[model samples]
Target: MAMFVHLTSAANAPGVRRSGIRAASHGQGSARGVYCFPVLPSYTLTHQWLRELARFGSRGGLVAVHVRLDDAQEVLVGRYAERARMAQVVVSAAEAVRRIAALEDPRGWEVFVPRAIRPREVHRVRTAPQVTGWRYLPDAHGARPCTCFGCRVRGGYGARRLRERLPHPLDGPPPPVRVLLAQVAAGDPGDAAALREALHWFSMRRRGPLDRLAGLATHPDPGVREDLVWAVAGWSTPGVTELLDGLADDPDADVREAVEAARDPIS
Candidate 1:
């Protein structure tokens, strides 16, 4: 599977690079090894990144910055960009001015950076449609708060920071699919984390039960689908192969990426 990042002046540049996404994280990436790549864009792009990040229990967000870009900069992406695990955009100087003027979101914040950082790597700025992240498994911590790396870092204020409040996330891995789905539907802020844990747990089950859960791929929740896609990525089962192949055109872009990322290089 190819890990791609979008690069440009403001990280939205037209430069698309095929590179491996490093798993190194300043904080607990997730109980499930959810990783994130900085991407470019405000609305549509942010959701895609967050959803992808959320699947692995890693958290991501978008922040808007005012910056100038070279003429060759890009403002949009093709299918590959949509399939990217991480994407960035660099609007040309002209496009930046136009977007800034045409901006419709009243709450967008401006980030003032030092002169050195501002001009050098404007693409590295972390932008978000919203901010959210989940921590390690809850059971491992042995506390109601699950004081694992995840809870300690973000103080559970990640996805919760969005205007649409989430109830909270799950506490630990579930033994099966129904319980997993219920935990997800509960709408916990840690829902993503729980999904990660469940993914980790499900991968070890016997073939019979594991295949049963795979059939639930039709689940409507994007969160569940995100979790499902990443959960089955590395498994060696006939059903898993078909499950990924069938998701090629999933309505959700992130789901499709998960499927693509799960494919074996030689397959």
Candidate 2:
């Protein structure tokens, strides 16, 4: 069972009027009573409030904080949403409404939820009543469309109306080897384009020139080291396997994994 808690104002009269919503907007009062509810945009809350909210989430409590892109804040990846350390289920408000309506709940929150969502309920677990697939249905009706993670993510609506901003560049000839190597040596953390182009130099055109980048084996950046591992794969260059063997115990775990993977590309 999914739950919603709309955040709205106290001055614009009756705040949120939906089922399970709370009405505590920006200016409720300086010293306000605290509710034990999971907060939306919990990142911006006071230290105490944030701690309490995080605690709720830690003990098997629901961590479904929904938000809409009303402004231009970039959606953070790995650090926010699905991959956030605490948040279990985060999505947008409009998507939540659509999903909730499909619950087919005979006597769920729809029975108690006001015509307006009252954001006041503290969330716990959200287990469904049962699970029935197409094979189990009496009429042999097929299961609902695949709402698996990959499909659902790909099914999300795109802003097709937005104009394309980037220019379409034609593929040009590769730069001379010396210039490419210079770029690779100068690559920095902020920009890996130079290093990537160098990797492209080795990957394409049936070339197996692994010896050219042998000096880069001890490059500081693990990313560069990892890329070198890939570039050397299937190249049959003499002493290349020995070099990779030395890097098998790379300091960076990712680099070590990359080295292991390169050891046997066919397998």
Candidate 3:
């Protein structure tokens, strides 16, 4: 048998002890399962998820549930960063343990068992140090964070403050429509960076001088043209739809993708 540990809320301890750790999806897909880490010789490494899980504000603190599973049992394993993309592979329980243990830095690794752990498979539920693992990402301390709108969650802890400290070029409150138009008009078409920035500001504000901005559809830089699609996506003005329809056939894949994303309400 291979040993593994699952960190969960202490509030569920009674139910967990009465039964076993129930299988549930961790926002990846419809496949419900219990998540665990291979038990390593190093105590801190074995419980590396404790601190990260606590960030979710688990009530009553958290506990570690040790489990035993057959070495031949199949499980899904992948890097924590790829979990949202469902980029995992099926491997035997023992193989998962060996693979993680062999990694020089196994900080972001995770395993997903496809079924509930039976009571007999549970070894014990015990108290764990609340501050044992890396938060955000492994070794993320002192690393510059990506403050893009997609990277930082709205209203998340420290998100507002972090954005204020380090604003992303493509994020934050956009300038007024008139200001963006003047910037775009005065910007050198050869200067892709400046043109892209002004266009991106228009994208954020979702309104601009459509006729003036539309001329950039033929800009040499595909990035500028891509930003053009986003800039006009929210416009209800006449000729906007026709302009977007023309952009839909852009030779650049990124520009075409931007056009498709712009047309989709949920994209």
* Number of backbone-clashing residue pairs for each candidate, in the order shown: 25, 12, 0
Q: Put down candidate 1 lDDT per residue, 17-36, tens digits, no spaces.
A: 12212121112222111122
Rank candidates, lDDT, best first: 3, 1, 2
lDDT per model vs. reference:
0.39, 0.39, 0.81
- lDDT computed for candidate 3: 0.81
Report how far residue 85 has shifted in candidate 3, in Å. 4.2
Candidate 3 lDDT over residue span 60-158, tens digit each? 788999999999999999898788877888999999999999999889899999999989898999999998988778887999987875455545689
Clashes of 3: 0
Candidate 2, residues 10-58: lDDT per residue as tens digits?
2222222233333221111221121222222322221112222232112
> Which stretches of model 1 miss by more than 4 angstroms?
1-197, 203-208, 264-267
Please give the ranking of all candidate structures by TM-score, highest first, separated by commas. Answer: 3, 2, 1
Worst 10 residues of 2 by lDDT: 106-115
Which candidate has the highest TM-score of all?
3
